[model samples]
Every structure is written in C-alpha cells, then in structure tokens.
Target: MATPRPARAARVLLPALVAAALLGGCSTTVTGTAAPDPAPRPTEGVGADPVAWGDQVCGALLSYYQPLSARPDYAGADLPGIKDRLSGYLGNVRTGIDTGKQQLADAGASPVSGGDQFRTSIEDLLNRTGTTIDEARADVDQADPNDVPGFQERLQAAEEKLRTIGAAEGLDQLGATPRLDKAIAEAPRCGELDALTAPS
Candidate 1:
C-alpha cells in the first residue's frame, strides 16, 4: 500500500514537472484558446461630461449677456477680446445707437415711418437705458421707477429666451460651449423680441 502511494505521488509530480518545463520552452506547446485580456479601457471622451459642460456653458453665457442688452447700439464687426472688453460691449451698444443715428441722417429728415418708428423707439431706449443703469447704482433704487417695468419687460423676454435656449436645441445640437456662446453672441432672444416689437 505504501509503494502504491509513492507511485501515485510520483505520477503527479512527473506531470507537474513536465508542465513546468514546457512553460519555460518558448512556444513548445500550443495553449488552448484564452478569453483574452479585457479590452483596454476606452480612452476616448473621458473628460467630456455633458452636464458639466452644460453648466460651464450656462455660466459663461450668463456672464457674457449680463451687460450686453444694456447697450443697444453695439454693432461692431467683432470684439477685441484681448482684455475683458467690458467697455467694448458698451461700445457695441453705442455703435448701435450711432448706426441708428447714421441711418436717420441718411434718411435726410424724413418724418419717422413704419420701421422708422422702431428706430426712433430704439433711440429713446438708448437714452432710457442710461437712466435705468444709473437707477440700479443702489439697492434703494433697485429698478428705475419709470423704466423699471419697460426695462424688465425687455430683459425679461430676453432672459426667458436665454433660459429656454439650453433646453430648446438641447445640449446636443448646439453642444455645451458653442451653443452657449452662440446664444450670447447672437442674442437670439433680443432678435425675436426686437423683431416682434418692430413695425409690422
């Protein structure tokens, strides 16, 4: 019985030794098919979370548009963008008023008609905007007493459009950055709102 046990042990040892030797020999035997290492974790698009991008986009638009509406005569080719350009945007508003004035000049003293009425209204708005801004200098003057409702109505419509913009095209079509940037640059809210307010 002891001899049989030894023989059995030897048989097990012999196979294991042979297997070890085979392992050392490069390509001495073929391995059965293996499952293969899990595909390397994907590296593409690792840091592009849409929600995070959306928030960044939202914040940037808010910052950009905050002061734009105040200045309506802001018609320039583009912005300097070297410095903060807070004044540059104000310049745009100035340009918008200037452009309106230039058009009025070109019209050569024609009494205001259809579109002209809207233009005149805008000129008046430019003046009112200055007064409105002065009123906001202190909380006691939270809003301009007279222009408050008008100003609020204008900005409110704009804000409503801006608020819905992210949801409308979806973060997908415009994407986070460009979409947000587009809303700021084009001021779509102001576009439609202004058009509606303009002559029929």
Candidate 2:
C-alpha cells in the first residue's frame, strides 16, 4: 500500500474535468437543483390552488353574509358584488381543473384513481361554488342570498373537500388529517342547516 501511491494522469484528468464542464450545461445533463418539471408546475396545472380560491370565497361570503345574517331583509344589498366575484373565481377554478387534466396527460400519465379524486373533488367544488354564486345571484335576480341553509351546507362541504385535496398531495395518499379535516368542516356545516334556514 505504501509502495503504490497511484499515478495522476493529467491526460485523463484534463478531459474528465472538461467533460464535466461541458456536460454541466448540456441538454441531457441533470443537476441537483433542477430535476425537471415533467409536468408543468403551476396553480392551474398540477399545483391547483383551490384552497386559496376557497379561502377567498369564504372571506367574500363571510364579509357579505355576516352583515346580512344580522339583517336578513337587507341581504339583497350584498348580491351583485358577491355574485360577480364568486362567478369569476369559480370560472377560473373550472379552467384550472381543465388545465390540470392536460398536465396529467403531458406528464405521460392517465386519468387514474388519484386523478379522479382530484377531478371529482374539484368538480364537486365547482358545483357547490356555482350554487353559491347562483344563490348570491338569486338575491339580485329573484331574491337575495339570504338565509339559505342548504346552500351554505353545500358550500362548506366543497370547502372541506378542497382543503383535503390541498393538504394531501393527491387522492391516493389522502391520510388522516385530510379526512378528519373534511369531516370536521362538513359536519358542522350540515348541522347548521337544521337550526338556520329551511331553504333546501
């Protein structure tokens, strides 16, 4: 071991070092920082931002409805603004689901069960959000977005499902927190219907 220190060949070493330098910027090269976004990473794509959308919708709902809650007769006053915002946000998220579908395809993946979970959950969200928008619009059109307990229940369920999907990576790995979170939000929303309004 002491006799053989091994020879350093600059001939081999220079080319290896040059090769590393060359490949560093090569198309086929990989780096620790960038593993490549096999599927485009974006909110409307794989990084669906439904939870943020829900939170915004909730904030809007709470802003409009809470005041209306105290004065049911004046509920129609808050209709136009809430309806416009809700419709726009829901429309945007619907587009997001469509974008996500394309992303899955681009990633060389098919519509699997996990994708179904995300799809179904988002579709449910779209429906419920649409219902809220309708309820809000009904306030402007026929009536007001007043004490509609049933609509609230649907909205809350949609919110919960969105949260679950947001917290979990996807459907297949929807673990305890996601499920429990959904349960917690959903149960209370459903129960509120019984005591609040009979509008179903």
Residue 99 local lDDT, model 1: 50
* TM-score against truth, every candidate: 0.23, 0.27
| Shift of residue 177 alpha carbon in model 1, Å | 43
* Cα-based lDDT at residue 138, candidate 2: 41
**Which segments of model 2 are wrong by more than 4 Å?**
1-77, 109-144, 148-154, 167-200
lDDT by residue (tens digit), candidate 1, 25-135: 011121223333222322333113222322322232222223344422323412222111323443443444345344333332112112222224433544444333233
Worst 10 residues of 1 by lDDT: 1-10
Task: Tell me the spans in candidate 1 whose CA falls farther than 4 Å from its real position.
Answer: 1-83, 109-119, 130-200
lDDT of 2 by residue, 1-200 (tens): 00000111212322332232222200111112322223322445322432332223223223322222231122233433443443344344444434433433343321111223443443453345444434433432332345455434434443333332211123334322332222223333222322232222
